[model samples]
Target: MRPRKLILCVEANEQVLSVRKFLLETRGYRVVGCASAAEAIEYLQGALPGSIDLLMSDLQLPQMDGNELVRRAKQLLPGLPALILSNTVTGYDRAAAADAFLPKGACTPAEILDRIRILVARKRGPKKQMPTAEMMPHEMAVAG
Candidate 1:
């Protein structure tokens, strides 16, 4: 199977970006880390349909912000999963665009990786099937 492609939209922080790249690549994901929301949008414009499987972004950004990034990304790739990690805790709701919110200063690298794995697993998991009824009537013989 082809490797899953992921796009990470974050501000112009080399340390954070480096750590994220290391973590994601270690997990076998093809990462395209963008320093700003505008860069991410440019990538989306040229990206193939369904190319980006996941988007992990920092909530606070200089230009467009992670929230807007996610909204636009959803429009481009509806099934794509997103996670918003930020130091500032305002305006991040589980019900909103991001699938998960990670408090930047609070969460460790391991914790962040774990959350990413969980989200990816959920996205790739098999479709749910209805449970079979415990009781069923005997089938009538067909008059073939």
Candidate 2:
């Protein structure tokens, strides 16, 4: 049986969507492309929880923006992997929500695909359990 492929792609531009669709299909991923954040929300509402393996979104979108989409999608699917594809990314753009950032103007298709692979690998790997300071003697002593 073919492996399950689940992805949410939100981009406003038609050309970008086409390219993204091509890239994802080439990599054997089943991509769900949406033109806006509202559309993404609608799609997610119908999909099963944990069905989306990754969310690839453009930073700028109409109605609702990419950051907001990432924020809301995470609330619905905690631990859902996200990647940002934007021409205007800033330091503040690097957040816990986005696992990887692809510079829209600078990155080639190959680079984007490679980054996707890396992010997917990270998601498939064992979950990271953060050690609380109070749970670690050394950390608690350091804090104290």
**Over the stretch 1-144, how does candidate 2's per-residue lDDT look in tens digits?**
325456789999999898899888866678999999999988877777767878999988998778788888888777788998878757335444677777787888878876776666566655442232112334535544
Question: Tens-digit lDDT track for model 1 on 1-144?
Answer: 334546554555878898888877865567888889889888887888666767888887787778889899888877778999888766566327888888888888778877776666566545331111111112211211
Q: How close is every model to the real structure, measured as TM-score?
A: 0.77, 0.79
Q: Positional deviation of 121 in candidate 2, in angstroms?
A: 2.2
lDDT for every model? 0.71, 0.76
Residue pairs with colliding backbones in model 1 are: none
